[model samples]
Target: MSWSGLLQCTAVEKNGRTVISDCYYEGALKLTRPVYLHPSQPTIYLIHVGGGYVDGDRYKTEIMLQEGAHLIATTQSATKIYKTVKVPVQQYTSAYLDDQSVLEFFPDPVIAYEKAQFYQEMTVYMKESSTFIYGDIITPGWSESGELFRYDWIRSKLKIYYEDNLKLFDHLYLETSTGMTGIFQMEGYTHFGSLFVISPFMTQDLLQKFESMAARFPASVHLGWSIPMIPGLVIRVLAHETHAIETIFQMIHQFIREECFQEEPIFLRKY
Candidate 1:
């Protein structure tokens, strides 16, 4: 029902603290005042005025962090993509990080209802001295009829660049045409989640530590950790529910906060 929306935000360090230097948004996209809850980072929550996205909607965002700045960007709530008959929803995000800067982009999960079609493309450009943490989840929307994985399609791609050179490219493509019920596809799972950390802090030692954590997941859940061509680690998870994956990501976030930033994890209270 909407044409498109755009949000642009720039962050800079001032007096040893990160602040939103400039921000602008249009259409359904909105942003709240940046909050410095933690001494090491400033937090910003993106808000959707419309509550959910619908067919024919296109949204894009760009975030820029100046040198030595630290920011955590997240959404107020889960993004819901409603059913569609014709047009598909499209979303694109681009982030630029200067040397010694840090960015933590952890939006809530996305729920795709029956017949919904969604596509997302994200690119992050950073210096080798910068740190980045990004994550997302995709789950079938609730249905009164108890149907799941009925969405028409859900495709997402993420690309990371260090020193303006491509370091990692991750992709996920799913469609109803491929039979979502197939064991090789969803494998009876209703949700999939991913967490990525790109930083010089992610050494082989830390990778081994995270691998120990991933190995503790229950048999019902499929969790894997891998080192891509980039200088970081990726955590991929599939499960019948969402809470397990969410908890693991939170633990990973906490680990990064304590080890790399030497700061305690501040609970992101939305209420």
Candidate 2:
């Protein structure tokens, strides 16, 4: 079944200096239920909904954040792109952040079955003082079913903008036989994820703290935090074990929550 929905959030300061709006979609199969979360009175809301895909199934989501507002959005579970003999399954997501606004888009993960093809893209617009933390986890195939890295193709792109100026652009392409043993490849890792955190308010000391915490993990787990082009930190990890990667992500998320939001992480309780 094909389904679609949109989510919008707007914020305005009391002095009426700034205004912004954020919108997105949450839709999937009709058989499953959509997850919802209302964190604050009128500022934060999280919704996650997805379902099985058969033939010619399409999923799309869009999010927009108005100026001066803060928003965090996450998925309840990883999205599964089922393999089909006839047509390839598609999932599209787009996000917009208004001037002086912040948005965090971190989905659970995307699981691709053998012979499945998937495409994804994420775009962000930023203004001065606007911050965004975005990431995604991708797995080759279901481990429980004895399936290893057997997907056909998985492609992703990320674009970042500061006002009318472009800050960062990235593209990634992966396949089952992408060579997991090479020095620059996945290096025998079955699952991988990338995290990008952008904020001008971050200090050198804080960056050091984050890096130190990341060093506690295994050497195989790649971690890097920097402010090379953008005023934020980026972490990339590849692990042969899914749980290990998940644990590291959870820890990093919690650290950011405490430092940025001054609130406890919510996903731990929900998971």
Candidate 3:
């Protein structure tokens, strides 16, 4: 669809403070003002702003975080790319996190229709004491109505601070056809999601804990944990159901809530 609309929301908290702005919808929304939070507050602010498809094939969203701020931004719902008679749909998101800041970008899964093609890229920058959590969900195609598997291609990239300082750089690509099967790739599953966290305090013990949690899920779901050169842990899963994928995402969120937010004042506010 054509890029006919845009929405932008921004939040900032510092110390024990919290500040939120209204959702801005216009040709393009921008957060020129920096939201600040009290160091003691440890709050998370989420903003949902994006373009709803209409007729064009291209849409773009941008996010920026200042120094020492913590924010968790998510879209209100999965972006719908209506099937068209002409070309494939595309959505682009760009994010920036500054020094001593923490950001979690966990949007709901995107459901691709038959013949739909999607490409997404996320880039983050960290200076000192900065932490980030990122994740995405994708389906081979709409499973209802007995559509089964019909998507052409879906690919994504997660890039972080350019240095080997944390060993946190990875790329992912998935394609579906009438052929492939079993455990490693999709194992006959039609839904998949991945979670990545960047922190200065990741360790082998923490990695083990995450792996153990993932094991609680069904065997149909492929779960794995890795400690990349980056200072954080990475957890990935491929499942056959949307609810199962969401359950896994919520589990990881709870883990972060208990482990990272226990002593901090930052609270998770509802969307």
Ranking of all candidate structures by their lDDT, best first:
1, 2, 3
Task: Give candidate 1's TM-score.
Answer: 0.94
Which 10 consecutive residues of model 3 have the lowest summed lDDT?
39-48
Per residue, candidate 1 scores C-alpha lDDT tens digits across 1-271 of: 4537889999999999898999999988989998878875789999888988898889999999999999999999998999877888999999999999999998989999888999999999999999999989999987778877778899999999889899888999989777786787877777899999999998889887777776666677787778877678888888888787777788889888887888888666365
Alpha-carbon lDDT, every model: 0.87, 0.65, 0.61
Worst 10 residues of 1 by lDDT: 210-219
69-180, model 3: which lDDT tens digit per residue?
Answer: 5666655566654454465555566556666667767676777676566666666656547778777887655545666556566667767763324345567766666343
What digit string (tens of lDDT, one per residue) describes model 2 on residues 103-133? 7677767888877777777777777677787
TM-score of each: 0.94, 0.79, 0.77
Flag regions of model 3 displaced more than 4 Å: 1-10, 20-55, 143-145, 162-169, 178-184, 263-271
Candidate 2: misplaced stretches above 4 Å? 1-50, 54-56, 143-147, 218-220
Best by TM-score: 1
Model 3: lDDT equals 0.61
